[model samples]
Target: EEEEEEEEEEEEEEEEEEEEEEEEEEEEEEEEEEEEEEEEEEEEEEEEEGEEEEEEEEEEEEEEEEEEEEECLEYINFCYKLVISVCCERSVVVVPHKDTSGVTRHVMRGEKCWCCASQRHFRCHTTCHARSLQP
Candidate 1:
């Protein structure tokens, strides 16, 4: 009977050890899950920051294009007299002095004049008039 009690005690110890091991495994799995969630949150934040940066870059590009268009109108002399033909039928009057006034206000915020124009259009009014003669 004592021998049997010893064997039963040994088996109980083994079962206890197995239960402890299972609990340790469960704790480790919980820790791993927490770590994975943290990593995913970090990644999502990074992606959000990246998207914001891209949006800022796109806004900058759009502002630059708007600046270029405004400068084009500024440098062109007699811009008020310039009549732009839309598809060779209707004509749109380009009053640079009035239409470009708002754009100039924005450019003036950076204290820059309308000096940055396309290199191809070197001459002010003469170049456009010359181009109009071409077929």
Candidate 2:
């Protein structure tokens, strides 16, 4: 009877040890699963951040392009306005004066004045008569 009791106690101890080991293995598996989930979440967050940054960079580039286009248009309009100068005779268009000295047949920036023009053209007159053959 004493031998039988000792054998039964030894068998119970072995079963308890096996149960503990199984529980430990289950806990380890849970921890591994949790860690894997966290890593996956981190990867997703990184991808989202990268996409957002790219979108922001593209928006900034577009805005810069729009600003450049607007500036170019304004510059073109201003230059055109300067090119059409008002002559002295019939004053309609007003523009800044730039002297192109001794330039006949080609009027630049409005008036063909005394110093710059030939003898026939009056001050501020749009009409320019061709040079006479006589001296």
Candidate 3:
């Protein structure tokens, strides 16, 4: 009977140790799962930030393109206008543009003979030191 009691006690102790080990393993698994969840969340946040930056860059590019389009349109308008310049004695010609209530639509530098010899800004190439151009 004594031997049986000793064997039973040993068996009980072994079972308790096994239970403790199982509990430790479960706790370790829980910790690993939490760490994985945290890492996933961090990755997701990084992706979102990257996406936002890309969107902002795209918007800026679009704005620049719109500004470029406006400039091109202005150039096209200048090309289609009927411009005439008159100058005398190798002088620069200052031609007339839209006269908005005596406000003088086109403003430029150099003497206002403004015919031939006008600067590139004036966009005129006709010179009349000899005779007037036939438009």
Candidate 4:
């Protein structure tokens, strides 16, 4: 009878140890699942932030392009005005004038005097006279 009681006790102890081991394994699995979920959440947040930054960069680039286009339009308009005032009006001249210090200044002065007058002088004069109804 004593021997039978000793064997029973040993079986009970073994069963208890197995149950404890199973509970420990389940806890470890739950911890691993929680860690994986947290990692996934972090990755999603990072992706969203990166996308926002890219959108902002694209907006800035578009604004810069628009500003450059406006500047180019202004330059073209200025050139048109210069051509009209200098090439069409025949007001360009290379003359001598006295400056504020009584020094003689011989300067080629006009709206577009930087252009080659020798090549366009005849055409300009004819066009100007025709447009003005002059003889």
Q: Highest lDDT among the candidates is held by which one?
A: 4
Candidate 4: residue 67 lDDT (0-100)? 90
Error of 2 at 67 (Å): 0.6
**Per-residue accuracy of model 4 over 1-135 as CA lDDT, tens digit each:** 899999999999999999999999999999999999999999999999999999999999999999987865664455445545654556654333333455554333322322233444443433332222211
| TM-score of candidate 2 versus the correct structure, residues matched by position | 0.63
Q: How many pairs collide in each candidate, listed in order?
A: 0, 2, 9, 0
TM-score per model over all chains: 0.58, 0.63, 0.56, 0.64
Stretches off by above 4 angstroms in model 2 are 86-135
Candidate 4 regions exceeding 4 Å error are 93-118, 121-135
The lDDT values for all models are 0.54, 0.57, 0.58, 0.59
Residue pairs clashing, model 4:
none
lDDT of 2 by residue, 3-89 (tens): 999999999999999999999999999999999999999999999999999999999999999998786566445534433333333
Residue 111, model 3, lDDT = 37
Q: What is the Å distance of residue 134 in model 2 from its true position?
A: 46
Models, CA RMSD each: 11.3, 11.5, 9.3, 10.5
Ranking by lDDT: 4, 3, 2, 1
List, residue by residue over 38-72, the lDDT tens digit for candidate 1.
99999999999999999999999999999987766
Which model, 2 or 3, shows the larger TM-score? 2
RMSD of 4: 10.5
Window of ten residues with lowest summed lDDT in model 1: 104-113
Candidate 3, run of 10 with poorest lDDT:
126-135
Cα misplacement distance, residue 80 of candidate 4 (Å) = 1.7
